[model samples]
Target: MNTFERSGKHLAIQSWQKLNSKLFSGFTTREGGNSTMAFHSMNMGFHVNDDPDKVRKNRKLFSEDIGFPVENWIGSKQVHAENIVKVSKEDRGSGSLDFDTAIPDTDGLYTSDENILLTSLYADCVPLYFYAPNDNLIGLAHAGWKGTVAKIGPAMINIWQEKESVDVKSILAAIGPSIGHCCYEVDDRVINEVKVALDGDTVDTVYKKNAAGNYQLNLKKLNEILLLRAGVLPENIIVSDQCTSCQNDVFFSHRKDKGKTGRMMSYIGRKGD
Candidate 1:
């Protein structure tokens, strides 16, 4: 079953939204915007060669559509690494308008602060949304292969546990849409890294040997395995089965578009209606 439901402009994580009325968590699609060609429309990443003005307008339209003001949004300068930054209201508007002001070298964001919308741009990368209701903590991590092998999801759980002095079992994680195993084949190099990252843990469910001798890796499941290893309860996790590559009309896939395509945004924030 799909964890996210379409709500006009974006896919809302209904389960998360239901857990906390003030919590706002969802992902944007490659639609309802002003961008053109290569980007086409709803391109949220300013560094993706899309028109700056158009990207800005797209941000404005999305923020208005979601009812989270443009000024309350924060973005990251994602380098495909596992750096997760904890933000607050004081850090609002950092990357809302341009890339230069975005939080540097960060692929994930967390906040106990309200009114600060944390966002990360994606094109087939796994968007990991985390929430610890005991502390009202919400977070997002951009998990591409690199970030996944680096264990960014577990890293976020560890940080939040430390941040709130709470048990990791209390954390709830949602694995959003990304390139699925059916569409993602990797060479021995990536497979080797996955093996090393798991530290000799079982990977039977994470990947498989395809007919071509290459491996079809499941990034979303890989992340879930790591989260389970990190102590997040099995029932506390939900994975989105929507493959960006398969659903090209609803999402923009880097692999599907041959590296030249628009980006979707994954966001989670704490704000009241």
Candidate 2:
């Protein structure tokens, strides 16, 4: 992954092809902006205790750095559900001022319109960006433990194929930074849920029981397998090795911060043709 400091935030790229003169995608950190302690610096999420004005300013800097209008970007309320909304130009600036009507309890957003930017909130959860070059469609989803267990990753692919005529095999996927196995200690319940969610081919490799009897799960690998099962080419998917808990200085980790932490934004949009 390549990192760059922008708007006092750290941005990472899973693949160079994900970047473009028009398409913009990045993961935000706790630097930059004007929020005070805890949510200090560039905190883009408004639901947190961070002041709304400060979040707005931080968002302004974030939007400008990515060359998009601050008021034009749309963010989901992120209910951790499997619902994926299809965005349009009419949805611009929906959640920037109000989360009620804007977000509306969705975990994923997709769009073929260039004017619409699809964004999802993430603190420690994995941010999955989907790009179908053949169909000129883009999607972004937030996958926490529950959502992952529900296999929302594959569901998103199914939606694209059914709604947008997307060719799953030609799509490219990128998994952003999140809590890794080294820090994501799980109990028997989560391990069982994961094993049940993943297929037989991936069950053995996705989780490992340590000497202490605790299970360490690799969410990145799990999602990679999900994408492959959803028909995406193995070589077309790239996962970031950056662990949020391991590298707290550059990214936000809910585990490290004990639930109070800033968020990283993962976005994908089609270029205007």
Candidate 3:
């Protein structure tokens, strides 16, 4: 996968087929938009306490570049849960509908219909994109600590299977950029939780003890395992080795920003009508 910039505010590692298509999807960066110091520029998350006007403008830039109306994006409130919601064209503008009764607790969203954009917000959390290239069904998920521990990848795959009747093995997965283990220091509590959730196999491969004995967990690697375990082919998985905390210039790192920062978005959708 090779990286490309869209609307100058978003960055993406393009898949082989996506390089020349109207089906636009990618991860956003904190650049090329109107925002203050903490939020910096190009911040797309309104929930991060960035100015509402700036967030709107940034989102508008993204929407225009992608050739979709800004209001058509289906976003989650992102409570770090593993709830996978199956959305359709009819459900368009429902979750983020009216801005008040928006979705409150979901980390994964799936849709087989075209025209409705599926998005997952992230600062450092791993963004997983799913596409059944044959059926053309697509989905996206925000897999943080809680979402990973809850096995959100498998949950999303199961929902897609049931809802769209697509085979799990037919899914192609792309794990977007996130906090690498070199910088994602975790305490014993997170280690224990991840170990238990992964049944010990994920411990040695994804976690390492530093000189100070604190653990560093690689959420990207762990999520790759999750994708494989969920029946996605190993060759079908594309991982962005770029680290958010490592490259603060192109990404928003929650740890690096001390929780006072904006977010980037990983989005995927079929070509609109």
RMSD of each: 1.1, 2.3, 2.1
Candidate 1 residue lDDT tens string, 1-273: 689899897899999889887888989999889998888789998988888999999999998998899999999899999998888888999999999999999998888888889999889999999988888788999999999999999899888777678688788899999999999999999999999989977678899999999999999989999999899999999989999999998899999999999899999998854
Q: What is the C-alpha lDDT of each candidate?
A: 0.90, 0.77, 0.79
Each candidate's clash count: 0, 0, 0
Error of 3 at 47 (Å): 1.2
Q: Which stretches of candidate 3 lie over 4 Å from their true place?
A: 1-7, 16-20, 94-101
For model 3, residues 1-273, the per-residue Cα lDDT tens digits are 434344455665466336437566689888788898899898878787778888878888888777777667888788888988777887666433233444668788887788888877888998988888777778888899888988998887877777778887778788888999999988998888888777776457788999888988899888888778778789888888889999999898999999999989888876655
Candidate 1, lDDT over the whole model: 0.90
TM-score of 1: 0.97
Top TM-score hit: 1
Give the alpha carbon lDDT tens digit for every residue of 63-148 in model 2.
77776776677888887768888888888887875555566888888887886667777778888888876677878888998888
As for candidate 2, its clashing pairs are: none
User: Lowest summed lDDT over 10 consecutive residues: which window, candidate 1?
Assistant: 160-169
Assess candidate 2 and give its lDDT.
0.77
Candidate 2 residue-wise lDDT at 163 = 78
Which runs in model 1 stand beyond 4 Å of their true positions?
none
Q: Order of all candidates by TM-score, from best down to worst?
A: 1, 3, 2
